[model samples]
Structure formats: C-alpha cells, structure tokens
Target: MAKKDYYQILGITKSAEEREIKKAYKKLAMKYHPDRNQGDKTAENKFKEIKEAYEILINEEKRTAYDQYGHAAFENGHSNNTYSTFTSSSDFSDIFGDVFGDIFGGNRTKRAKKGSDLCYKMEILLEEAVKGTKKEIHIPTLQKCKKCHGSGASIGTKPYSCSTCNSKGQIHIRKGFFTVQQSCPTCQGRGTIIKHPCNGCHGQGRVETYKTLLVKIPPGIDDNDRIRLNNEGEAGSNGAQSGDLYVQISVKKHPIFEREENNLYCEVPINFTMAALGGEIEVPTLDGRVKLKIPCETQSGKLFRIRGRGVRSMQNRNQGDLLCRVVVETPVNLNEQQKNLLHELGKSFNDFRGENNSPRSKRFFDGVKRFFDDLTR
Candidate 1:
C-alpha cells in the first residue's frame, strides 16, 4: 500500500502550524483510539496511520525533513512498518486527559494521579495588558495535608500494600481471547490502601486551603492569552507532583482605543473646517496625547498611522502602530450669524453637485441618473 500524505491524514493543510496539527491529531485520535474503536480493524489501522503522521509532524526536525523528502526522510528508522504493533504506555494524559476524561480513558496512568490543572480567568485593564503589571490572587484549592505530609496516613501511621493485586497495583482480566492487565479495582490503582486514615485529609491525602500567589503579568499580553505558574494547582494524589495553574487573561475594552493583534485603532472626529483646511489635533495614546496633522481636503474615515505608538509585541519585540480614523463632523445647532456665514460660503460655489465643490456627490448623482435613465429605456 502507498504511504498516505501526513497532512492529508491529519486533515490539515501544508501550512498548518504545530498547534493546529496537535488539535487535529487529538480530535482524530480520540475518535479512532484503540480503546474507543476496539475490534474494528479499519479504525485501528487508521489510528496507526494518524499516530505515525503526528509523530513525524509534531517534531520540528522531523517535520522539516518530511517536508523536504516526504516518506524517504524516515526510510531508515521510521516505524511505518510497525502498523500492527502498538504501545500500552503513553504520555497522552498530560494534554488530552482533561478533555476526554474518564469516559475515553484509553491511556490510563499507571502511576499515582498528578494534581489537576486549574484555570483562573482574570480581567485586566487594557493599559495593564499593554504595560506589565503585578497581581495577587487568592484561590481555594486542595493542598498537601501538613498532618499526614501528603501520605494520607496519620502522623504516627502509614499505608500498607493492597492484597487484591499482591501490591502490583494491577490485575489481569481475561476478556474473551486475551488477558488484559488493568488497574486493581480494590486499591483504585494506588497499589496501597489506607487503613488508618488521617483526620486532617480523611485518607484522600489533600486538605482544603486558600493560597495567595503574586503573578507577574507580562507586557503586551493579549486577551485570551494565558500565563502558566508551575506547581500552583490542586494537590496531587498519593504523593504525585502538583499540576500547573493557568492564568487566563481578559482585557477590558478601552473607551478611546481598540486593539487588533498588535496595533491600536481609534476614531478621531474633526470639524468640517479643520478637515477641509487642515489643522493639528491631539490624539490619545496609552502614554499620553500626541499631535496628528490633518492634511488639506482630507476625506472622512481616512486612516492616519503613527508608527511605534501601539503596544509592543511580546514575541518578536517589534513595535506596532496606532491608526487614527478621521470622521468629519457636520456643523449643528448653529447661530444665525454662523448660519448666514455658512449660507454665503455655500453660495460661493457655483453648483454644489459640481466636481469642484463635491466630487463624490457629483459622481454619486451621475451614477443614480444613469441607473434611472437605463430603467426608463
């Protein structure tokens, strides 16, 4: 059989980024996983193909070599020949465990359970997102019990081996034709049982507590961006390591400016006189006010970009620009003298629909006239 295209197998384009590739792999892997599609030979083969493609594509070096030479890149050591072989142990839980959960728990963790990652949604001002800021957050989570020292046993006592699986933490189950080794039901895969439970954590080993952490918000952080704090999540089970805490950011909308990617956009209103004759106006920036000059006969909604005035990018360290859109404000609620002055100025033009005074209006009227004339014909 001819080897399938890796990008085609993952249902992603050639230009798909690493994150996109991972996302596509996770979705397909969850569907055709061996545990999910057991006894289905077609699904199993498809899953093997998917895994091979993912392994090659997810790595920077492998992906580059694959892109350059296709299947020949890994001809020497690639496991494409091992489609029938599969491994029982995997680190898939670190990424997709929270998503699939226990329902699709194909790759079960044989070791003690690690702490669950926690997500904290924090709303910050746009200014704070642009410039760096510090925040102190309090979260109620499970911590290792001080009384039992995270062992789940009382200060004086300790846990003993479970007799169900002979301290192996796993049991063999004969399912139809094959004997499958699975986690022991009696000990719940911990390999040990707590006879004398601690009064502080009551055998679970973790206690409820509130923790205060000072998180440093990085500059140029955008909305929906997350910052990870190591070992700041819930306490693990059976002395496993604690998981990480993800600080999800939500930037509050600014009154004067809106951010798009790295750039900032704001609408600046200019009077008809200022727009027609040209003048200097002050525009608001994150730091302070800056003067922007309006050119003569500047049209409404024209963008004026001020380079290096927007938020600095966190990744590339390149400065962004600030774009100001000018909108001409029509004169309203004028006095008699002002109205008379405007009427005289308006009369100065021979025809309002002519190209000299209003070129846009003249073209618009001409188009309208052509449309009606065509209709009449």
Candidate 2:
C-alpha cells in the first residue's frame, strides 16, 4: 500500500496545532470506531488508519521527524521508530483511555472514588424565566459525617494503609506477557482501611441528609440552561470535596405567548368588523396590556412589531421585539337582529362577487377559471 500524507489523512494542515489535531482525530475516531461499526471491515480499516495517523502526529519527536523525512523517517533504525519492544500487541484499552479521557471520561482503571454529582430538573413559569426569579429547592443528599470528620475512623484512631498494594490503591497483574492494572482487592481501591470504623456512618464517612438550596435564576435563561452549584452534590469519600449540583431549567409553556431566541410571538384574534372598519384593541404582554391599531381592511395573519417589548438578551443585553400576528376571527352565535344586519351587509357587497369589495376572491376565481380553461383546451 502507498503511504498517505498524515496531515491530509486527518484533514488538517501541516501547521495545525496539537489541539486542532486532537479535535479532528476525536471526531473521525468516534465515527469510525470498531465497536460502533461492528463487523464492518471498511470502518475497521479506517479506524486503524486514523489511529496510526494520530499516534504518529501526536508525538513531538515523531511529528518532527515525519515533517523532515516524511514516511521514510519511520523506517528501520529511524528516529521516529525508536521503540525496540513489540508495540502492536499493546492493549487497546490503554490506548483509547489515553486518547478518549479528554473526549469521554477518565481511564478504565479503578482508582479512588469521590462524591457523585447530582442533577435537578426545575420547571419554571415563562414569566419567571423571562424576568428572573429565585427558587428554594430541597434535595436528599450525602454529607460528610460529623462524627468521623470524614476520616472513616473511630475516635482517637486513624485509618491504616493497605498492606496488599502498599497504599497505592492499585495492583498490577501479569497476564501471559501483558500487565493489567486493577484496584487493590484488600482496600477496594481506597488505599487505606479503617480497622475501627466510625459508628455513625459505619465506614463510609458520609451520612444521608436533606438539604435546602436557594437557586437564583438569571433573567433570559433559556430552556435546558444549567446552573452549577459547587460542592452541593454528594459528599466525597473520606472528606474529599463534594461534587457539584446542576440545576437544569425548563420554561413552562405560556398561555398567550411563545418565545424564540429573545423574541416573543403571539396570535391576536380580531373580529372581522374590527379588522374591516379599523379599531384599537388590547393585547396582553409580559409587562401589561398594550393597545394595537388594526388598520382598515386588514388581512388575516398580518404581523405587527412592537419594538422592545420582548425578552432582553442574556448574551448581548439587547432587547428584542414582540411580534403580534393578527388573525381575523369570524363572528359566531349571531342573534336574529345580528343575522339580519349581516345579511344586509352581505347583499351590499354586490352579491359577494364585486372585484372592488373582494379583490382577493376575485383574483382567486379568475385564476381558477383560467386553469380550467387551459385544461379544456
């Protein structure tokens, strides 16, 4: 097989920074990953190709040699290929852990456990989200034990280091010719053992309790926006810092308005008479009711802009406009006198076919007539 340009394989320029190279590598790696593709030979080969390109480009010395001597730099006894040991048999888990720790999470090896983060989904009214408000939330969580002081040891005593792994919290096992790292079975990866455990929390060093927090929601916060409260999550093992609490915001649907990127949209229904004769009507706004002028012979679905009446932007601090779409509503439930008045009014429209009175209908009918005329011909 012919050698391909490493930069071109990763779709990056030769001067691309390390961060840029990693970014491109991650995006392509995820798509062509062997596990995701499963039994597809092409994707497996592509993943191998991407992995090979990345390993060469990510190393500084190898990258410099490649830049100077190209693919020939990695030939026998070359500076770029200095490793003497067999590397093709290295565990895939270790390689992916080193690469995807930044993209996904940390390594697969067991280490010390810490406090787990917590997430709270909060639903707020549209008005409150637009104007900003404070909310009090209560959650059940784990807090560091007052009795143990997070040491997990009984009074007047301290935890002793594990003898199995020598307080390293991990053990290495030789499988055939490969070495695999695993948590110390004696201490469960805590690197220490409490012989005299605290009576209050047994040996966990944390107690379950209820907590109340006052979350101040910012104005113009959109749905799915999260607020992070540090150290509000479950207490860490043995007094480690607590994980964070994430408050996910979800805005309730408004009865009269819908929001879109700082803009407020509303449908205003006007009676046909009010639309034809032109009049002022009251429309509800976030602040209060405002007057809207319906022009004479106003058509349905006409949009009117009320500037600066919408939500203010959180990013740029600029206010958006309120867009009111007027929908001409037909009158219903007519009395005898009203029915008679409408009948007379209808008759006055020249049997409801006058071009001047119903210009849109006239044009529509004219188009329909021409369409049929052409079809017949």
Candidate 3:
C-alpha cells in the first residue's frame, strides 16, 4: 500500500513558511492528541502521523533532505535497533541532570570547563562613530583560585576515584529485558571526588574577582553591532580555556543627523525667499560643514545628495552619500509692511487658471463630477 503524503496530511503547500508549517502541525496535533481520543484507533494513528511529521520537519537538516529526496533520505535500514537504543537509554534522574546542566549549570566533564561568555554594551557619540577610538572596560567575574592551583583539594591531598561506580563514571541497571546506562550519582559523573576541600576556593576551584580589558572599537559600527575579543572573559577553572567578550555598540542620538543603513539624513530649513530664488547654503557633515546649491523654484521636501559624506560600510564597502531634505520656512512675526508686500505678490498671480494651469487639480475635480453624475443617474 502507498503511504500518505506528509504535506497533504498537514494541509499545506510546498512553499509554506516555517511558521505556517508549525501552525498546521499544532492544529492537527491538538485535534488528534491521544489523551483526547482514548478509544478511537483512527485518531491515535493520526496523532502518531502528526508527531512523526513534526519530528522530521522541525529539524532544518532533516527537512531539507526530505524535501529534496522524500522519505528515502532516512531509510538506512528496516530494523528496530534504533527504537531499542532509545528505550534502553538512561533513567530520568541522571538524564535530567545532564540536560539541565547544559541549560542552567555547566559542563560535567572532569577537565576544566570554559569560562562564560560576557557581553558589554558600550555607548559612543556620533563623532566617535565617524572616527575609530580605543577604550577600557571593567568586568567582574569568577577567576580560578591560586592557593590550591585550581584543584579544589588541600595542599598535600588530591581527588580520588569514585567508589560507587568503580571509576567507570556510569552505572548500569536492568529493567524488564533491557540493559541501560546511568551517570554515577556519587561523584556527579566527574569520576573523582575531593577528599579535603581547599580553604581558598571552598571546593569550587574558583573565586570572584574583577578584570579590566582594553578594546579598540572600529569606525562605522552601528547600533546593536558587536565586537568579539577572544579569550578575554573570566578565567576558566583548573586548566580549561577561557571564553570570549562581546562589546556591543550603541550610538547616541545626534541633534542634526539621522542614520539609515550607511546613509545619513538631515532636515535643512530654508527661508521662503531662498525657495523662490537660487542660492548656496552651508550644510553640516560628520567631518565638517559644506556648501550646497539650491535651484530656483525649489519646493519644500526637496532632497539633495552630497557624495561620499555618509558612513563607510563596516562590511568593507565604499562610503555612502549624505542626503539633505529641504523644508521651506514661512516668515513669522511679520509687521503690516511685510503683510502688504506678501499681498501684492499674491495679487500678481491672482489671474491663474484652475484648469490649464493646474493639471492635478483639474483631474481631481473631473473625477468628482463623474462620480456625482453616476450617482444621480
């Protein structure tokens, strides 16, 4: 008999997004959950099918292979050997320890563990972002103990092999007809236990200390960008390698300029006289102020681009351009003489035709006429 199609069972197309696939799987799983359909064999089988589909689709590598080659991608053999291995795995107690250690605690290996990664958020002025600068940072973390050489034992004593598991580090148990392996509870799976705890570290082999490091921040870094410093984190316990320090960048708000990608944007206010008559004005840049040319009859919100005046790309691209948006400023606090002059200027264009002179206005009024005509008929 032919097997059912996974996509058809999920009720989604081949080009469905990741979120869409998850939504479809969740809907089917909730409707056919085993506890909800206890006596129905059809619903139980459907629930199993949904579980198998999610187990494949949720994994990136498995989903890619299945999409390209179908179910044949996972047919290494036709045996229950894989299921037997899973069923005979460790019990919940030790399994929980190993999983939670990775999530909350640390590694369980006998060797020294790597230090934790550190994040530092550094703020810089816009001028500093234009040009690179070096700075110092102080961080407090756990440093390895120096008294007992990070061994967590007294000067004359050392750790001994665990007696519970006989130094094998794992215990075996028989359940029904299957044999399973579980981590040793006596030594916490470290295979060794300290006889006399160290006085300096209190048996942890580490102490709290503060460290200061100097970091050179490069130019062109934007908000949320990070610089990684290798082996600059807290000292590892015993002889393990140290982790890394990540310096996150944050640019302060500038009064004149706003950044977008690699480009800079600024609003330049121009008097109404300048909008009517052509003139040159000085505009500000990261380096200094430069002159910009405005044409006659320039309207408000007109944009002018200055080449090579923006930020350089951190990813090795050439410098970008700075864009200036012009905003026409009307004169305020005018006296009677200024108002009369403006009224005289307006009277010169009072004979302007609304149809031939303004095509946009004519088109809008024509559309309104047709709408009312259609409604009346």
Cα lDDT tens digits, model 2, 124-164, are 99999899999999999999999989888988999999888
TM-score per prediction, in order, is 0.69, 0.71, 0.64
lDDT leader: 1
**Candidate 2: Cα lDDT at 190:** 82
For model 3, what is the alpha-carbon lDDT of residue 229? 93
Q: What is the clash tally of candidate 1?
A: 0
Candidate 1 lDDT over 144-204, as tens digits, reads 8888989998888888998987776766665543346578898888788889999999988
Better model by lDDT: candidate 2 vs candidate 3: 2
lDDT tens digits, residue span 1-377, model 3:
65566788888887877667767775676577654566888887887776677667766787888798887776776222221111113522233333333344434454456888888899998777766788889988787778877777878888788888776566666654334556778876656788898999887777888888888878787878899999877767654677788999999999999998889999999998898897999999988899999998788899999999998887886798899999999999999999999888756644332554445556787899999999999
Candidate 1 lDDT: 0.84
Give the per-residue Cα lDDT of candidate 2 at 160: 94
Higher TM-score: candidate 1 or 3? 1
- What Cα-based lDDT does every candidate model obtain? 0.84, 0.84, 0.75
Worst 10 residues of 1 by lDDT: 94-103
